[model samples]
Target: MEKARGVRTERIPLGKLEVGQVLTTTLLDEKGQVLLAKGKQITRPFLERLKARGQEYVLLEILEEVEAVAATEDVPLEVKKKTLEDLQDTLTALSQKKSASIQPLEQDVRRFVKGVRDHREVVIPIIQLKKHDDFTFTHSLNVSVIAVFLGKFLGLGEEEIRLLGLGALLHDLGKLHIPQEILQKSQPLTPEEYRIIEKHPVTALKILDEYAAIGGRIKNVAFEHHEKLDGSGYPRRLFGRDISLLAQITAVADIYEALTSDRPYRKALPLFEVVEYLMGNAGYKLDEKVVTTFVSHISPYQVGDVVRLSSGEEAVVARLNPILPFRPFVRLRIKRPDGTVVLSEEIDLSRSLILTIVGEIELQSQIQVE
Candidate 1:
């Protein structure tokens, strides 16, 4: 394997790899041949080919400093961990028809709402670094977090925000009933398969009906989040104002989270493209007020993040622009052949029409080998 300066290598079992996961380092075969380039999203076909070649393990270049800044900036790590654990326990119990208490989940929602209220700037990094096995739980957590952020931005009451958070957390509860093979299929789903997928919302309602504590607003969000403003959505195609505002908020969050996240079928779309999609669907498929509030306030990159520019240079996010979320102030980083790094003056991307952020650099800090 070709070794880069200041980087370490580790061998990982092929069986542990998941489709749609983006590796931080270059992947190499056991024979020291390059298997996949670093920073590329893994695909199902790649795994299949590796298995065909009788490869049981692959080597990865691990940057020592990457984990320090790996987690999303503002969200507390403990809250995220507890939420995931509670969500798994709650959902598992519900699916098995065993008696379960949502009190833990309720506490989780309170924490998420509090987090959203405390952080002035909220950013949902478009590239989801998640495992394929727990995607449903992770996706639900993300949606709830985003929904709470939006709820606070929209001036919702504290109790309302809590309801929205709890509802969003359980939005995809019915996916547990769906077949795993269909959910994990990398190929485009057939129409029949899609029909089955659409039934998840109905299934979720049936499961939720057992809980007396779940309010009508929360139930509405669980069932109607898939419904569009334009009468084109699934289950019961209730149009326009028939959909509650809380459900509308969850829908916006759900769509944004799903589109920005990597799926078994495709890689995650870029942040710019995802924002444009939300804008395009505003007033038609999604609520205009919710979309506008989300697009205007939610940031794609946080301060201190390293990003790649369209011109091939790298820069650090110095500040965020509230009005123009996609455009932020960035300071350029220049690396010299003599193993030194230089920081340039900050440039406001909103003012500079010539430059645009193309992608985020996964490794936040890089060290030179002496």
Candidate 2:
């Protein structure tokens, strides 16, 4: 591969760009006097060929360009701390009863809660890591992180946050005894299989009850996380006030995690879409107050996410409003022909525009699916 003096291209993709390498047209100099602005990753041979043909390089910055770079390097410090704690929690929860380490487990719970309380942008990395594994144990870790983060953000005390984290982390421990075939099946489970699966929470409660330190707290969440406010849920459905606050919080966190997770039968729904689904199920299947607080912490628009606008301009979510989760600040990534992407101007949709996010783009495929 050849190099250009003025343009600096990363070696990986350019060295491998094939004969018919496709390139998107991000800019066009109709004015001819416009200064050449740098585009995001262009092939070295393409640049050389363009220069040879006396054609100018039209600068086309790619969406998530900086994010792509960051993923390959070291994860942020807070993320590292949270990750270690999550891993430790998962390992401890999965070990047999005799091997359960109490002191380290308690320390991990405290550290995890502290990490979530310290940082606002904790969900994406935690969720991303779990998505790579997506195992039952890994899912528990993700749920715990989100639960504690939401709890702290909602002004819950540190002790409550720690209890919440530990409870969420062990909420589904009964699944450890489940048959792998039933859990890993790609198709819908039969009625018999579903019945067996439904017994997991009860089994989880029994297992938690065995542990002296975490037993009572974990039992509350494990037994009642599936129980609904209307007494419609399974495992001896209890109504309203009978369910503990710990149970309600765990229930909301469980539902949110399950919806956003890629399951055996369905793909993971985007965060905004999942929020809408939960909102629609309010009062009937979920707690309205719990959902409200959960949505507030997760942020409707997350950074590095690509979304479609009302006017058909696709943009990346840049920043989010703490008070308003439905609306966020965005930077235009793709324009409608003449409308250039103004990186300098951050559009706060909560104040200026009434734009609705249609969907999010998948980072791996770069596909925008609703």
Candidate 3:
């Protein structure tokens, strides 16, 4: 047996296991190789095979139960709901090749820009309104929200922020022309299909040309959001200085939103992984200034969120660290003998060298354990 922080790892005999038992901790073999991951259900066949292999004991990292806390909203839910509805209508009209007014969408962008300015200090949380069927529209809204926030953080003027917001909102307008089958395919896309996908920027530019009311800057965002600074991105393959600053901002927001949101191809990645990706691509592929500003301002875990610590204990996010958003102050949950969970003293993770947040605890999982 061994213990570190609040976490305990113990060797339990295979005879103690039972069929249909769901494992909350990973089961490791004698050599410390993972035999079964956490959250997996033990079965008779697996236990029989382990016994046949003369495996008498397995290691388990015992985790404590903690009550899940609901997330508090930084952006107004009403604004997101209204914007989604208007975007859906506009996209539907454009897809059908009918005349559509972007006035409603313009108003939506203004409201979002104002919201971002008002809540400048609040850490933005992941939007939970994503639906597989409404991915295009929801993605657009998320991109717009992030872009507007980034623009404000970069100290851009109000008019520029609004235009950036509007452009981000309509950045994926070309997707409306893509066939639903190709867009929603769960399997890997072939080269031909990928080529078709790469044409979205060009398609969007063509679509935007019809709207004389839309300015060149807004059109640039739509057409150049996918272009990278390294000349590796598709379409025109433009390098640094060629891509507009607004497009660069939108590109950062677009990648963040897409990777963080659940997609048809894969599950939503953890915030830490997404941030690492953005950091890795900072100078070579993405704008260094935009990426740096984004990383410093964005918090992976929001206040009131329930997260699992490296110690195997669960904690609630108490406060954010402005300089290091990843490391924040957290209140650990103490499980009492009577099964009641209580909050312990607030621990500043930035000062603690041994403890770190590993992952989030979903409300459903907490309920199941309780």
Candidate 4:
């Protein structure tokens, strides 16, 4: 197993497996495809399932230091750029009426979803290093990934999750038809421009209609992803129970992707604050159940992220705790008056009754953490 700078990897056979072993590196099949990902804390039932599948070995993470290793991109940089370029090409073709095939887009989405699932170590950080030019395509991919996780959490079937993935991926398809100047406008939009923006869902629905290969239910995301439960959303303002569940989930994902992305007008919001916003929007704008399920899948405290505890000492999130989204296992770094350093002190927050995290250790802002 190959080890990165501060991370270590150990391969163990199924018979030697024990619950609670932290996987720092993803396990791969003989063909090198990821079978299981890092940050997945081993559990008895899960381990038993792995053994039942005849899996022989797995590579797990071992910590070596408290160094601030840069967050790795979930999808490799080259892969992401290529995927975005392909998505843009597909969008251009659809807009020009040269083709009605969603095949290219679908293939990319499927590849991306599988990549993120296997590379859980970088799922949340996938968008951290995004180029501003790739925002639209990357946003679609990110939302699709988040929706896939949400669907699985809600016990949806694989095909249903695929539909959700497609819906989230194309939720903003209508935006492609809008004028570029209006879409990328740096200033606040005029009423007319805002009205035009509201029509994207309907516009996307029309485009999806031409492609009979796309599922009818999947097309609803284009029509109603913006609809609010309170009847405040535009272009047909269907309220409460009227919106489809897929559209509702896509709506939450849409809001999240938008808020966390850097826009022409503002910076991305910190993840916990965004989660707080989603929690607040439930019942009024978003489906409460879907919102609850969605947040559980988001890994907020990323590995290598330095954070401040309620106790006033600072620490780095040296490891991730799969069961706890916010509280991960942290390695404490204390500095003495003589400029000496102390490291190797690890604390698993899952078992800690005290030393709660108050907020991120401001230094994390200096580096982009997932």
Best by lDDT: 3
Q: What is candidate 3's local distance difference test score?
A: 0.82
lDDT tens digits, residues 1-370, model 1?
1111234578989998999999777999877889899789999999999999899999987644211112234456677778888998998888777898889999989887777777655444332335457888988888888888888889999999999999998889889999998999999899999999999889988988998887788888889999998899977998999998989999998988898778888987886899899999999999999998888776777677899999999999876655456777789999999989888997777657589999898634211111
Clashes of each: 0, 1, 0, 2
Give per-residue lDDT, candidate 3, residue 188: 98
Question: lDDT per prediction?
Answer: 0.80, 0.62, 0.82, 0.72
**Highest-TM-score candidate:** 3
Q: Which 10 residues in a row give candidate 1 its minimum summed lDDT?
A: 64-73
- Per-residue C-alpha lDDT of model 3 across residues 319-363, encoded as one tens digit per residue: 666545667778998999999999988786766779998888952
Q: How do these models rank on TM-score, best leading?
A: 3, 1, 4, 2
Candidate 2 residue lDDT tens string, 1-370: 1111111122122224334545442333323332223343445665676557665434333322111111111133454345445555654464455456456556667777666655535232334344333367656766776777767656789888888877887777777777888988899899999888889888877766666766576578878888888898878888887887777887877878787777777888876678788788677767777777776556544566677878687777665544454456678775447876545366666555357676666443121111
> Whole-model lDDT, candidate 4?
0.72
TM-score of 1: 0.75
RMSD of each: 19.4, 18.7, 14.3, 13.3
Residue 162's lDDT in candidate 3: 91
| Model 3 alpha-carbon miss at residue 330, Å | 1.3
Candidate 2 accuracy as TM-score: 0.67
Candidate 3 to truth, TM = 0.76
